[model samples]
Target: MLTDVQLRRLTPREKPYKLSDTGGLFIFVQSSGSRLWRMKYRFGGKEKLLSFGTYPEVTLAAAREARDQARVELRAGRDPSLTRRQRQAEAKRVDKQLQHVGEEWMKAQSARWTPRHAEDVRTSLERLAWPDLGHIDLDEITAPMVLETIKKIEARRAKETARRVRQRLSAIFLFGMAHGLGRHDPASVIKGALAPLIKGRQPALIDLEELKHLFHQVELIPAGGIEEPLIVSSFD
Candidate 1:
């Protein structure tokens, strides 16, 4: 069922062309004479094409397997082509935001922060935040995603660090909004979404006798330093 043009797409370079058994996938020669696997399909009443990657790198078996999975998705009322396109679009948007914010943040801190502190903030953002959320659009960042990221930091018991990162992220989102890069400020709306800080409970004193004893203990310490009695009574 494969056409000659399609066969020629797989012209000999140093390898033989392999076609899928179902005739929907094939290895074809590219303009550069390199064999490439391509899949043809129809979804949502529209024809679509997908590249299975170049030869050798994608091997015949691997390409067929990938094509099979795509076909399975297509049969299940899904449009794999549209899904792929959306993912690509999202990646492009995220990359743009990351680059823009990174440059702006660098410029804003150069005059105010010391070299070491600047580097620390830059390095932390680049390493921790960039890898996961770098490519996502700042406006598209949801409260759930921000909460999830905060939870990751909280799990390590770095509450202060988590708070600082949240502040930085909020600033980045604000910057993006100011520059007209995005329409919504998702970070600004996460006040109630984050976990609340809990203050430690102080011990309660039941009677005046305990209070007098505490004061006596406190008086026995040095003038400049009240030591253990003060430390104990402070909790009261």
Candidate 2:
């Protein structure tokens, strides 16, 4: 067993050397003076080495615990090195997704949406959402940030535009979530926060004088005339 004092006193040499401890665990002293922890084992008749960490950082007890866990895995016929590599790859893939941007999300939708629509979505994010929320990690975006971001559009009296932007942003976040990037769609939290749209009255000739004038104009036109029907339907 290697004590703390002995491990600390072990300095660098011209070549790397391994100080073995029980159960295939050892301290590797490198020529550069770095003390690293390593475990050696055989799996499927082939020897393999698994690095734990450095001295002081990994410590003697931590190295033993890691080695003990590796032993359990070995007993179960599992390769700890392969499992660790798979986990590292998965973490890297997740990090790449999390670091992705709104533009990437927009681009992914290009196959399903028209170019103009995709361009509009990108433009909305760049103009309204990006300044405040785009550069941030997808999981870090909260409902309040989404609400505040849309309020900028609402401030310009673009109620309908604000609604469209919110819908687009929500779709983007949902897409990100499906791809394992985002945690939730913050824009969905403010469903009814924007101003309601005002409906306009239908076109009609309500004035009595306007109705008489329309009849007079129809009479002025020749029978079976296209202009008369067009003018009449324009008021209808």
Candidate 3:
């Protein structure tokens, strides 16, 4: 067991040192003059060391709390070290999958989109959606996660961009499902979640007399070569 007195009386050394406590826990002093806590345990017939973070920073109580949490995990027949590693591996896999999906989605839409529009779509997805939900398996993505991503865009008052992002994500999920990379398309379930934009009625016009008057006024205006025609056609 480690006592408060022993922990408090501990001094820094030029070289790293270890102070063992009861059970498998140990306090490690690094050459950088910082103290860290760790636990050595046997899991699956192999030894594993789990880091509990730095001392003074983690504190005695916090260290004990972390140790207890690890013990609970062990009791459940789970290896904390393996769990951490698996999570990291899964995150990497998801990142790769998203990159592939994004590329495929861009290619599929390229023919129908203008050059600038295609570039903008790619940029928006890469900058916004890719960072948050990109590391999640397509099948595992929830409605709330999609909503949260849209909320981020909405926060910037980007209504049109948000709508396009949702559409792009839906397409990605559909593509993933087609290739067996995903199960459900949460984006499909939440369609019409955003507010609709209303298109106002067209301007009302008078009879032929008013039209002729407008045309006469237009003819009376002095023209400066093609510039005047270009300006006049812009309003039409």
Over all chains combined, what TM-score does candidate 2 have?
Answer: 0.46
RMSD of each: 14.1, 18.6, 14.8
Ranking by lDDT: 2, 3, 1
TM-score for each predicted model, relative to the true structure: 0.43, 0.46, 0.44
Error of 3 at 74 (Å): 30
Superposed model 2: Cα runs more than 4 Å off: 96-236
Q: Assess the local accuracy of residue 175 in candidate 1 as a C-alpha lDDT between 0 and 100.
A: 68
> What lDDT is obtained when candidate 1 is compared to the true structure?
0.65
| Residue range with the least summed lDDT across 10 consecutive positions in model 3 | 227-236
Model 1 scores a TM of 0.43
Report the lDDT tens digits of candidate 2 across residue range 1-236: 88888887998999999899989999999999999999999988899999999998988999999999999988888999998899999776554342254566666767976564455556656767767876577778788888888887776656555777788778778878877776798888897777776666434555333344356556556777854444432210
**Model 1, residue 31: what's the lDDT?**
47
RMSD of 1: 14.1
Task: Report the number of the highest-lDDT candidate.
Answer: 2
In model 1, how many backbone clashes occur?
A: 5
Higher lDDT: candidate 1 or 3?
3
Q: How far out, in Å, is residue 218 in model 2?
A: 55
| Tens-place lDDT digits, model 3, residues 94-191 | 64475577777788878876565566667777887889887677767899889888877766645555666788888888887787777778876666
Candidate 3 off by > 4 Å: 1-96, 198-236
